[model samples]
Target: MVVTFDVSPEKEGSVLNYFYRQLTQTPAEVRGIDLGGKTAIVTGSNVGIGLECSRQLLDLGLSKLVLAVRNVSKGQAAATELSKDINLNPGTIEVWELDYASYDSICSFVERTKGLERLDIVILNAGIMATEARINPSTGHEETIQINYLSTALLAILLLPVVKSKRPLAEQPGRITITSSDTAAWAKLDERNEEPLLSSFDKPGKVDMLNRTFVSKLLGQLFLVELAKRVPSSVAVINMATPMMVYDSEINRETARSLMGKIVEVFRRRIGYTAAVGARMVVDAAVKHGEETHGQYLGLQKLKPMAPIVYSSEGDHLRSVLWRETLEEFSFAGVEDILNEVNSDRKEIL
Candidate 1:
């Protein structure tokens, strides 16, 4: 599992600078891409970048779009708004209920997808950033960790076969676009123990809420590394996209209420891309296809090298440990059988 690259200090620093630049960069305009007759599912599509992504997809001619949201009422409102705004044809958009905090909800969402004749794209866009540590009652993990990392991973793995099965009918290979963040580069997880990192949150003051968010995103990148290895290229292509700093979203609002949060918000407002611009990165990652993008991290609408730690020996170890512990968490939540069946299917296909 030692993936080596000859990265020089100068090159690494340059990449770091490029990522910093993305905080202020205006995303390139997406154009000329046709998604006609294609079907896409976007989680958390009720607002923010997810909603913008759904709008863009519909405008680009996707035949069927599912807006998966925790609030079905809001999702229905979004669907209605999008249909009118885009002057969408009747029945082009549908809303479904999904609450990542609940394992049953995730299962129900996946089961519903089985009814689709073909699923061309899956955007794992639902996530949260908590300013305080709180445990999810159902998962017994920190709220951010459960929603952003664990649940997102569970849903992505379950949908692998559904997307893969449609590859043959797809104009191009099906895609699973993971919405990650540059903040993942800031996470520093303890590597000495076998216990899942999020479990440590139960101890008082052990987990920094912001740092937990970083770790959750880092876990997402790690999951993609393992996922790319297990599935065939033709079956599915998984990649992570960093929207950088998106302003005016609910996540940003959570960070903007405190004094320190206010200062950070000012800096973000001075440089960060608008929610619409950030959504372009997600849309490009979803509709664009290429071998180079598989298992890669994309930023500002282009494939960029991940944080240096992601390629280091320590990173390889973390990836392995995270993958194993993640499955264990899923098992505790009663998805071990599903995990085994998916892996068995992937092996047969590969």
Candidate 2:
């Protein structure tokens, strides 16, 4: 039984240490699996663990890499730096615009990647946290809910046709690895409060509504598990939960200059896991072949059971509801129609 907390350095330290030990010992051996013949798409790869994951995957020799970023310039800069480090071939890495906050961007990315020979890995790594008010983008969603969960769900559904197409039913399956957080266990999905999430500081007089981080995280996992079930045996969906606070490119350094921020930074340094360490779970999940680990939510590098809340019948029901509402909110009816076309095309070709 794992004890859950709000935001404690002590609890965070314990989780970070457990993962560091596990990651530090894994040697840099590229399993004979070559990604050159296949394709991989990673969101939010411009920085943080996403970038590290992309770099490591490239290190393993991928045929093609698509970095889905909102800012093409930043994406290009990051790609240049990474290429310089590992001698990146210009043909290997391609940058595409994908703002998870926008449904149109999701559709465009999906249409663009449909041209891949086979998508071996699709990583949903980009996420955001609202420190002030919960602002869902123009799409009218809680900003966190939209980008972190709904957008990813839409993208996954859009890409499912491609994932299910190139692979046979009884062989090594494709993979969908969603980057989740330990914070998800903090809150259970509340149907009554289906209101869009407010930015952290947007509340005029609201205090209790300020902290639903746990609820959001839990719901995110629930959504992934449901998607896994919906497309079972064809695609392996693994939720990578990092127990520790991670040190990533996204950490705001200027904010850390304040006395309070500096003090907080000290504790973060003492306990936060590095991007490389946090990335092992995703890499392991992505490369694990066969159907044995399909539809399982793994923590760190092992296939462990999800938090108890994720397994509850009530939780699953909420997940279904959220999924439906998310589609409606994101105006994703077109996704289903598009997948129908892809499947139809396959049938016609056969």
Candidate 3:
């Protein structure tokens, strides 16, 4: 189904109001969902919504949970802390290193996953919102674009085989949930232009930090569309969801660096949901059943319509372009072999 929306770019007040409602409203409880015998991996699980999602999964009785974080020490500490109240089996939670800033780190993490027998859930929750312009040394793209979109796409695509392989063993289909945001509604990529949109970041002053984040998230959502098209539901399911105004995250600090920015943040903190509450949508996306979620963009704990551009002919063309350019970028990064392995596995399953 081609879902479309009439949403225009959200105004500042409307965005704030949205945050207010999510903050004040009580979230529905997720109950009676058992994840026993399942192996789940949550990237950036050391803190924030990622950590909360991992906690919920463990609370629901998942057999194994991998906390993929950049800092092994922090991850281990987080695991130790989370295990305190959960009453989980010994060694049920393990910390693994994953540096989204480095391709080698991502590759190592994927290679390590090969040892797991049943990979049931993967939440691509690791991301950053850079306040200043900077480029990752590995990929040479804007930091936000690299971590938020490119590396995320690479990691998700590479892990497809692992998730797909374990599907038959799962009670329901394996799920891959990429953490997107309602900020995608503000994305304004030049849909008519065919040039690789990511390259635009290399040009000085072409894109600001805020727009960089918006486009990066939009691109992630676009990648989800392409991914859903390629993978059959029986193999695995791919979807994007917005955690919607998580004020307790590190992003608030990054985005609110200046005095004026800090002033705005006070209101944001008062009106945004806690990281634990914000995590509910992501947990829902990960464990929810059925093909109805495949390729859908979820918000507020439901399958919400995407922006009109995502359903346009131009959007279709952009998706194709983005996919092609992304693979080409991966090839340049010396990770084509990983892509090859995923594709080969996908073909065998088909």
Judged by lDDT, which candidate is best? 3
TM-score to true structure, per model: 0.89, 0.79, 0.89
Per-residue lDDT for 185-292 in model 3, tens only? 677665338486668665556556777788888888778888777766666778887788777777656878888778878877877778888888888888874688
Per-residue lDDT tens digits for candidate 2, residues 1-350, read: 14233433334324454456455544243356666566788899998878877887887787778899999998998788778757655578889999998877888888888777667788888876544335554765566566676777778778877777755556466777777766555443444244433222223443332244445566677776665555545344434544236655463344465676678778777666677766766766777544555555555555555555665676666667766665555454565564455445336645
Cα-based lDDT at residue 258, candidate 2 = 67
Error of 2 at 241 (Å): 4.3
lDDT of 1 by residue, 39-153 (tens): 9999999998899898888888899999999999999999888888466677789999999999999989998999998899899899987788887888777788789988899
What does the lDDT come to for candidate 1?
0.79
Cα lDDT of all candidates, in order?
Answer: 0.79, 0.64, 0.79
lDDT of 2: 0.64
| Residue 87 shift from truth in candidate 3, angstroms | 1.6
